[model samples]
Target: MSPAPPTPAYRRLSVEERRAQLLDAALSLFAHRAPEEVSLDDVAEAAGVSRPLVYRYFPGGKQQLYEAALRSAAEELRHCFDEPHEGPLLPRLARALDRYLAFVDGHGAGFTALLRGGSVAETSRTTAIVDGVRRAAAEHILSHLRATDPGPRLRMTVRMWITAVEAASLIWLDEGKQPPAGELRDWLVEQFTAVMGVTAARDEQTAALVRRVLASEDG
Candidate 1:
């Protein structure tokens, strides 16, 4: 008879690695289920660890784990809009939107819980995390637009578009992710152009941006 395969070596995880593993597991659970519906045991099972192990890493229990998971998820959400400064602005924006929406698709329930509010796990910290994503995304987009010194109108326009994107994402999830992601991304890019066009009439900064963006696309 063939000899049994040798047992794999038992490797222990480092402190930071273990913690990250737990956070990743917690986020995975939170992705499809509301935080309130997830427990430490759920996280432990997902991570292939014990409940006490989870508690050891997050002594504050479920709330602590939930907060930590949100922080992790926040980082990912913020990075979704981090597009390189190259080529046409609309194409860049489209690529950014694609990432953002993919994240929303993957973290459906968690995204809803974070934005819809009123979750048992909801706290000031969680709200701040969400707000931080918004601010970071706005900054990244403004950077892409070369609006380092954005006027109030331009800033408001960008922020409003951000809000609209969030609302649309929520609605998209509620509608069972219909209309396809690519179509949604294109619609959002078009919306951005339209809003920028309207804002250009009153904001010289925005007008210059419209011209520059259009010229680049045309080129």
Candidate 2:
């Protein structure tokens, strides 16, 4: 009757739901090991679906699956920037550091795989994930700099700040994650604020420009 209620327009899912489903499937495989090592059948089994179903979402197969996992990690890191905090850089920096640490704590395997980049499937995955993360960090630092300095040197300063933070985190992870989470968090906040002039700036003059660029690009 009524043309079968129009099938509710096929009930298209929201993009977020589809993305979550894909990420769940990929993350499981990544947790196990390299995407190349994990077959489509394995991913389907992990996701509790048929092989064709997984292919339906990711036609590129293993490579696509690995990329999805990498994208998921990037999205998680991007979440830290979505917070709407208005204050000195230290608090914001601390909040971001806490968020990052929490993500690593929750998704240890995902983070580790992303960081190591050993496997063929994981190599590209790692590159994509790290690029996204580095961009986010650079953009955050750039915003703080523009808010304070607003000069030609802001870009270089942003790059240095981001690289420093990334290097520190990488070293910490390489050295067995020992220094304690609290101590690491404090250090990250202090280092970011000290290098980026977060407390000295009243507003993010460059955030608008960066946001425009991000809104245009998917990564």
Best by lDDT: 1
**Worst 10-residue lDDT window, candidate 1:** 3-12
lDDT of 1 by residue, 56-137 (tens): 9999999988988999999998788778899888999998899999999998988898899999888888899899999998
| Each prediction's number of clashing residue pairs | 0, 0
lDDT of each: 0.90, 0.64
Give TM-scores for every candidate, taking all chains together and pairing residue i with residue i. Answer: 0.93, 0.68
- After superposition, which runs of candidate 2 have C-alpha atoms over 4 Å from their true positions? 1-19, 122-129, 145-154, 174-176, 193-219
| Model 2 RMSD in angstroms | 9.5
lDDT of candidate 2 over 69-104, digit per residue (tens): 777778877887664535544566677777877776
